[model samples]
Target: MRALRYYEEQGLLASARSGSGQRLYADTAVNRVRLIQQLYGAGLSSKTIAELLPCVDAKVSTPESRERLLVERDRINAQIAELILARDRLNDIIDATSKPNPTCDYV
Candidate 1:
């Protein structure tokens, strides 16, 4: 609930209010929240996600928004590449450490 409120405050989400002031969300809000989580997990800042949200919500892109999205895509791709490299490095370490060693009792 706090997270929903934060997202609402950040303009990444919207909610309606009932007569008793309870929050109401449309069915689409679930997908929107998932997308928000994905974007954040992909390393986008809230501000950048906010800038991209309108285009996503409208399903229409202006030239400027298209360019911005392109830039963000590139950024995400770079981060993916970096994470892949890090994973490979960890795998290499694991392979090396997993070898049987007579000298190390822990092994």
Candidate 2:
């Protein structure tokens, strides 16, 4: 709920209020929130998400936005590569630690 409210405060989400002052979200809001989450997960800041949401809402992308998308994709790819390297190193350590030593009394 805090995230939803934060998104709203950041101009990334919208909601209507009921008579009792409860927030009402349209069905489309679900998809919007998911997109926002995906963008954030992909390493986009709230300001960047705000800038991109207009194009998303219009279902169109300008050349600048397309360029931005490419740049962000490249950044995500770099992060993924780093994560894979880290995971492989961790797996190697785990493999080394998990092997049984026949001469060890503790085994």
Candidate 3:
């Protein structure tokens, strides 16, 4: 709930107020929140997400927005590649240690 209000304050989301002044959200709000969460997970800042939201809402992309999206995608790809290498290295270490060695004391 706090996150919803924060998102709203950041201009990343919208809500309607009831007569009693409670915030109300449309059904589409669910999908919007999910997309916002995904973008944040992808390491996008709130400012960038705010900029991207209009493009998303309109289903149209300007050249700048397209470039920004591509840049973020490339960054995530590079991070993924680095993580895979680290995981493979850990696996190699585990494989070597798991083999029985006569000189090793630990079970």
Task: Compare the candidates by TM-score and give the number of the best one.
Answer: 3
lDDT of 1 by residue, 5-103 (tens): 999999999999999999999999999999999989877889988988989989999899899888889998998899899999999998998877799
TM-score for each of the candidates: 0.84, 0.85, 0.90
- Candidate 3, residues 17-96: lDDT per residue as tens digits? 99999999999999999999999999999999999999999999999999999999999999999999999999999998
On lDDT, the leading prediction is 3
lDDT of each: 0.91, 0.94, 0.97
- List, in order, the clash count of every candidate structure: 0, 0, 0
lDDT of 2 by residue, 1-107 (tens): 99999999999999999999999999999999999999999989999999989998999999999899889999999999999999999999889878777886863
Better of 2 and 3 by lDDT: 3
Order the candidates by lDDT, highest first.
3, 2, 1
TM match of model 1 to true structure: 0.84
lDDT of 2 at 101: 73
Instruction: Locate the minimum summed-lDDT window of 10 residues in model 2.
Output: 98-107
